[model samples]
Target: MIGKRVLSQEPVTLAEVKELTEAREKEGELTYEQTLTMDYCNKFAKLDKKKAEELIAEVEGLEKLSRRHAISLSDLLPSNADEIKLLFSKEHFVLSDEEISKLLDIVGKYKG
Candidate 1:
């Protein structure tokens, strides 16, 4: 831990977290926190890695959406404009109705 340094940081979806933790567990042992995170992700992650990636990409194409927002949208897969609005409530920008509709359509495509 002392020698290791982070080269970069990026937000990731729950599906990515689930995949990474699973790979790490297969390689060796996971810490308690890691184990808990794996369990949580297993239970809560709505999309698989591929679907999450696609969702993130499509969501990111929308104007005003950041990577963090895209990842959050992928993780949550909000079904309606109201839910999407709540997700963006803390953000500085507001989404127009057309943008929200587009987001809903994109999410609907991936959501099962």
Candidate 2:
């Protein structure tokens, strides 16, 4: 817990090849050759098939994307938390009550 890693602001570019042809098809109108190529690519490629297929149909649906992460966990919490006593009892292998209380105290700082 003394240190943490961080990511750079700029995104790394993926290699553009025959693989990205499907992504281009998803973006706009696909030519006859492009359609045939996409079909072949989908048949042979051993990649994230579900995600790739979903991405093909998913337009620039920012309105839905923007609201997707709007819901907050704090909204579901009750004023009294005794009902949810052991939030992560099975997740961790703590040895003592003092250690568990310390863990909870540290976890309390993360609001969202």
Candidate 3:
């Protein structure tokens, strides 16, 4: 099969964002989109690699959440319920405070 175009509306983890941006960088020059992706990746890179992975895992563990929402959480690694709610706004689902705390607990475990 030939190459397929990816829809950018979906949320992707910052790790994936970084990987894709770096690959594009090696291919010659970064496109405007690539530059934006790299910029956000750095901006949201508050957690180290392991902690980021934990955040992803935490977000994925929540029930009633779509994969896009989970990846968005991993990308932002937000520390509070408000930010999580904002990320889930387009997802059409609202997480409860207890659930938000659960995710925060998992992410907080790895925050050094």
Candidate 4:
């Protein structure tokens, strides 16, 4: 682990995590933490990689949402306005009713 440095940091959805871990597994054995992460992603990832990417892209198009929010939305696909609000609870700004409806509609499209 010596001399390891993070070149950059970015948010990733569970589906992306699953994709990466699966690739690592195919190459060789995963470390213990990676195995645990793979298990978690397998159990909770709601969408596959392609769908997740699409969802992230669409979500990112909305105003006031960051890449982190897009990834979180794509990963959880919150069912209702309340759930969506819960996801954004820590943010300084609040989502309007219109925005919440928009988010729900987009999420519903992907859920199907």
Please name the candidate that would achieve the greatest TM-score relative to the true structure.
Answer: 4
True-vs-predicted CA distance for residue 80, candidate 3, Å: 2.4
Q: What TM-score quantifies how close candidate 2 is to the native fold?
A: 0.25
Task: Give per-residue lDDT, candidate 2, residue 73.
Answer: 12
Answer with 1 or 2, whichever has the higher lDDT: 1
lDDT of each: 0.92, 0.36, 0.70, 0.93
lDDT of 1 by residue, 14-107 (tens): 9989999999999999999999999999999999999998888888887899889999888898989999999999989999999999999999
Backbone N/Cα/C clashes per model:
0, 0, 0, 0
lDDT of 2 by residue, 25-97 (tens): 6789988887787676555443243432333223113222221111111112212234223432343342354
lDDT of 4: 0.93
RMSD of each: 1.4, 17.4, 3.9, 0.9
Q: Which ranges in model 1 have alpha carbons more than 4 Å from their true place?
A: 1-5
The full ranking of all candidates by TM-score, starting with the best, is 4, 1, 3, 2
Top lDDT hit = 4
TM-scores of the models, in the given order?
A: 0.92, 0.25, 0.67, 0.95
Over 1-112, each residue of candidate 4 has an lDDT whose tens digit, in order, gives 8999999998888998999999999999999999999999989999998998888899889999988999999989999999999999999999999999999999999998
lDDT of 4 at 38: 97
lDDT of 3 by residue, 1-112 (tens): 2797766776656777687788889999987887988898788766555556666666666688666666666556677788777766776567788987887776566554
